[model samples]
Target: MTLLLPPTSEVPVPKFNMADLTARLLAPGKPQEAQQQSSPALNPPDAPEAHEEVRERRRAYQRPAGHPSRQERAQARALAQQYRDYAEAWYQALRAWDMREVKIPYSFHYEPGESDLDFLTLGSNVRTPTRYLQTPAGEFTEGEVGVVITTMSRAPLVEQMQLGKMLDKLRHTPDTTPVSLLREDGRWHQNRERVARYAVAVLTLAVQLRDEGAEGPLRYAKAVLAGAH
Candidate 1:
């Protein structure tokens, strides 16, 4: 028996020219052209204009001749006012705490006489002077002295000014200053317990301010108390 085969339709064959392929492969521009066609351009038609708009916006936001813009000025004023509020709050807290100075005897070895020649001839001797502090808690320990002195010394300028004002208001003598105390060679150290107590007191004040709807004072109190640790 003979088997019959099905008739097939004509199919077009794709023909590749070796010379054209070789030319395309050799031509550097061909790959770039094909890439340009295959992938979209890095920048669209409106890219230049968009970039210009962004640049213009940046320029608009930039300060002129180191002078801040109105918005920036407003922001700075707000920040300064905020710090002022913090200073005021700290002052009030200190006042409320009623820190009283107590006189204590401080003995130190010092070179007697003003001149170095006198020091060389006379030698150093122990001198006892009356010292004063709000508390005598950490008067002998180096660690506490370092921590308290360092913390107080590193206080922000605004806070330092407030402290100076507080000192003056409280009629505290120069010898009662933290630096002076620190220079006394273990005469005094800031009390960590006192600091922690003050922090808690400030936190309580912050809560009270919040309850009283005093947002500014509350925020200031919170900010001031943040350095307690």
Candidate 2:
């Protein structure tokens, strides 16, 4: 039986190739490529596209320091209540929005020579509807000396400034334009940013009114962000 004995001497260690080891460690691989691909490029703030974005452009209103005065707070509360009223009115107006459709009535003088049943070709341009009022005897009040004429140009349908137009204008309106002047009639004055805020208030309130129970919360959009188009 042959027995193998360990040599009483130091074993020679193989030298490592540092360059090769480094090449392997720093080598470009699928993971590197994947990471590079996943990384997003930073956008320049001064880019032309960035400038095109319409933001919540508003004016700075001066206010007293730290805590607002009681009178100011009361005024703020009043403004809030006023906005709520405007929102309800705007919602109702939107619900009833429709193109103007007016009608008019005309009277004809019966001639003895003409048959009772005759072709009545009535075609005229009128924007309001008109109906004749007759007495119990099925006749218009006799002895009517004057013609009570009434004319409507559909202007009554929109007695307020165009809200839809304002909505659009606010998106691209200049800083000087006042949109904060939201009136009880669902119209607004200049101030584009404030107007945008008002619109947001209305929409937010409207969504609430519908009781959709939308999780999270719907935010009001800025007028400047709401493009004129």
TM-score against truth, every candidate = 0.23, 0.23
Q: Any runs in candidate 2 off by more than 4 Å, and if so which? A: 1-66, 98-101, 105-229
Per-residue lDDT of 1-229 in model 2, one digit per residue for the tens?
9985434232212234444334434557765542322221222124444323211000001121234656788986676545444443443333322223336555444565666535542432334453332221122211220121111111243411243333334323424344234554533434545554445533443343343321112232332326522
lDDT of 1 at 205: 33
TM-score of 1: 0.23
lDDT of each: 0.39, 0.35
- Per-residue CA lDDT of model 1 for 45-160, tens digit only, reads 34566545444433433323345677888996777455444433443433433333444443445466655554443423434333322221212223332234344434676654
Give the range of the ten consecutive residues with the poorest summed lDDT in model 2. 54-63
Please give the lDDT score at residue 101 for candidate 1.
41
The C-alpha local distance difference test score for the whole of candidate 2 amounts to 0.35
Error of 2 at 161 (Å): 19
